[model samples]
Target: MGAKTALLAFTDGDLRPRLLRPVRTNPAELVRVLHPGYEVTPIEDDDLGENTYPPYDTSYVAVLEGAELFCDRRLVFDPPSRLPARVLEAAAGRRVIMHGMHSVSDWLGFAVWENGDLVRSLSLSPDGGGGDNIGTPYEFELPFWAGERPVKAPYPLPFHPLVLGQAALRAFFGFVNEGRPSPDDINPFEVALHGFRVADPTGREQAEREAALQEFLRKVGPPRQYKV
Candidate 1:
């Protein structure tokens, strides 16, 4: 089996009007926008470092002309690329949000960062109506100005219905904002979260991995139709 990979979502530069066109719905167009450079590079397995999981080589770089998306090994969307450029454009030079659904624990978590400072984080559990124990979905809006303040008070309600409590949100921001190294620099969480470790992937983990992926999709909900 190939090495496992974690997904990292970010926008590379300033959000431009031209890049804000709605994401194309055509599969070919979608593939083109998603893999703009079209070069697949081999990522060092060891480079994945400590986090929540092993790192896999970036199989492709997905761009919608505005946003940059990446996947370690598997293509999570139907057309192999789902990020709309507008989304990236909206996040450029500001905050980026990342959401993950963990199948092992049926948990959904999300984090927000602005200029590399952690702003918010959240997580949730299945509500019992979903199929196959898929974890809950998570959603949060990040202002482009998130890093202006050192810490913001917790919200009365979770930004998303699936997100359970304030503690997760606090932890998310703390994990990103507290002067930790980048995931590639050293172990990002090493100094921040002392006992945290990335999970080792194994052959027996396939079933659970698939379930976790499904849960992730369920939480991501549906992609918006591209208008332009």
Candidate 2:
């Protein structure tokens, strides 16, 4: 079974704590309003087929290995583990929505944001038992941090439930648990969220989206222009 998750990033530039609202648009309505298309998976394995959701036309890429999708909005995912790279990259430098379903081999998480600020980031993976990450602000590292992302042990591993300093814990996860760490504070490279369960729908399509958005912006300067 595949892991189903949708991470949405917005460009509104607010990072506050707010729950992701559910998708109000109906699937049948989506099919009627937009044309459907196909997108290939980012996995190295060629055996996997294409992803048929999002109608393939509403996808957007924020950066390399990062997907910034607004089409998903607040759609609910069942056991979400796989998310396109474009969506993950979108989470940084903007307001975003990330949700993951439980899976043994994949990272499962639920993180909510208010505007562009973080609120709660919880890891639902059972891999490390109860010691696994339950709450964190995992969304902060999505921006293009300047450094070589390590792929081995000892070095920082992305989304590995970083070691929170006793003093800093109150600000991060909102609570400090004993037996964790009390000395030095450190971070983990959550680049793996960008690497794993990712897909590449199309670079050309994303470019087109950016162009379309630009054109729309040019026509209407901002939301105030459309106010009645």
Candidate 3:
């Protein structure tokens, strides 16, 4: 299977206008912010290479009791909710991106917050295993979680809800770019393929990679549409 990727983002209240970018953080910093005392082995460049194995190559992992979370590999975790919750806290109310590639998970999901309030969240695994659609965004979900009412979200055209994995990235980054303080938003992110593109395709590999970049940038739909 290809690498398992996920788009985890935290944003300002109202769920729009801007994404909350917390201070710069890393694996060690994540430990302090999310789970202290938990052993964390930082993910180095080699860990992200194609040769890396499944789950391991996908998300950054750390050992936990009865649960070992590959930090970046948010989607593959059994419950899935566990990873995002920690991610939100780690954001501490800033917009951030967790692992964003590989693109595999039993159930793909998304969650957005408005003024620290969870507007809505939904997770669906292919097993027809079901997921949590609780109204509140507080609790990170695991199975056996049945909530009162299921909140709903508007789906973008041409994309099925089940296949929103790539779409999520475009939306968050699109929001991030449109709301950028200045030219910085237009700048490519340090990680992720957001800024990486082939100026001239010498072969099939580079050409295909460039095509993916074009599609990846469509999260905002049209740049002109976002202008006030």
Candidate 4:
């Protein structure tokens, strides 16, 4: 389970059907709309699979007929309930969906907003249990929360977070990051996305962000040495 994603979408209604259409898109304009005030330089074109978990300093964006998607690891907010105000503003009056997963930590999170109102948000991991869970469980989430799909013994959570993560990915985005492709699943490869190198205009913000990350890493220190 090496899959990972940091995806955000804003659409009029169902995104899956919109993605199926072959509509021309303006990726640069889409990036600008979502990342106002940031310096965005068009870099390359990439398919969904390759950009789902794009680099922290880069973003992959696309504007469909009535839908738009932006993928960047920076958008993977912990306790997704606290999505940045700017992002929420961009999603105003539109149905917004966000999904984040890190296979290394077996963590999964997802959030949904309808017309600027939060409908559901959840984030969880084995090591930390539920990080942030709000609103009622969606139909697709019921089975896992009910213990119907239990995790292996010796695990803390009722189910493997990543398993639920995959389910969430399919449920919200009409695709999966792993597993065999199903006939009904959306062919993300068919959807083209534009990549951009995003940076702050002043360079101060980027430096501060890097300094914070370094400080955090310093506190966490190196991995523990153990004999197997």
Candidate 5:
């Protein structure tokens, strides 16, 4: 349950099939497509087999057989419907899938779009309750929404958001980050990705962002422990 992801994909169709066969691509070119005017410097080769989540000011990108994926924590939005227009434009007329989860906060947000139209988008956590729920529930989400999977007693939400979070990963992306892998599951390790140092031209944006995070952490202090 400690696993985390910040993944976005643009695919012609099902990404799973395209992921099965790894394809080499120009990481720089892919980054330009997704990032546009951002300053990008090649850093190293990364893989989706692990570490799909990139750190602040970094991104892991890949142009697969028929899919393109970018991993960066900054992609996780409170309500996935607010995904930047530029990013969505990269997949105009194709299917776009976004999967974001933070195990520390037990938060999950995901969305899917086809042919420039949103089909489903959701964000929820026990602490924050539901954020945005648009469109009808997909088939894979039925069981959780139907109360078939209930959280243990003393929990606020009916189901663990992370549990359903993992389910959404497998359903939308054909893999699970924190659960037992199925034989048919895509071996994320086999998927090749390239890493890059992405930053604003002046470096001021990243500096200010880090400063804000530090201030927030200082105010929050140390983590508190609780017992059942």
Candidate 6:
């Protein structure tokens, strides 16, 4: 079993035109390709005013503890901020996984929690074989913060879900079996999902994605072992 819930973060809407859309090859044709459905607005003054850490795009996908989707672009939270009371309460005494795509470096990272305490964090990097090199997933005895309060650290890598899957699973399972946190609190389904998300390819094109991931892991070998 693995983490049942996960949080996914993506690029902000305001910078899409310049980052995702505008063809450096042809700037004048930008507006013509724009579609009403594709429009993404900048963060509002009120929202920006309250934000403490550097601004991040609000787009994210949060898979809740009970296997529900909470997709929104306004779920952004700054570093050092505590998980929402509701989110924390729901995750109380349970394992939760938070995953997000880093647009700046096109990397992905995940935090593993048990009984509301973080146990491990990991990120991957490009190994230059048209694949990724899995970095050592850091195991923590207690929840570690990014800057202030204990939080998971994000890593940089190429933005491919398959590549993210391997790193995420290794972290999740490694923490569950060996980290200081106890899995007795969180649901087993959550743990299973951690493995499933890494191995399953139903939603993604099965053959190609799985093949790429397998090839990558085969090259990288097992994650470096640490003596707890």
Q: Would you list the C-alpha lDDT of every candidate in the order shown? A: 0.36, 0.33, 0.38, 0.84, 0.84, 0.32
TM-score of each model, paired residue for residue: 0.29, 0.26, 0.41, 0.88, 0.91, 0.28
lDDT-wise, the better of 1 and 4 is: 4
Model 3 per-residue lDDT at 51 = 18
Report model 6's TM-score to 2 decimal places.
Answer: 0.28
Looking at model 2, residue 75 earns an lDDT score of 36
Cα lDDT, model 1, residue 213: 87
lDDT of 1 at 147: 34
| Candidate maximizing TM-score | 5
> Compared with the true structure, what per-residue lDDT tens digits does model 1 show for residues 106-194?
44444445565545444344343222212232332232113332224453322322222222322332222123334423232322111
lDDT of 2 by residue, 104-166 (tens): 344444445544355554543335322223234343433212233332464233433222222
- TM-score head-to-head 3 vs 6, winner: 3
Query: Which sequence of candidate numbers ranks them by lDDT, best first?
Result: 4, 5, 3, 1, 2, 6
lDDT of 4 at 204: 82
**Backbone clash pairs in model 6 (N, Cα, C under 3 Å; residues 3+ apart or in different chains), count:** 13
> What would the per-residue lDDT of candidate 4 be over residues 160-227, giving only the tens digit for each residue?
98888889888888889888767889888888887899877988878998999999899999889999
The candidate, 2 or 5, that scores higher on lDDT is: 5
Say what the RMSD of model 5 is. Answer: 2.7
lDDT of 5 by residue, 1-228 (tens): 266889998899988788766576676866776667788898888788676667788988877887888888766677899988877787767899999988888888999988888899999988899998999998889999999999877788888888999888888788888879888788788877788888878778889988999999999998999999
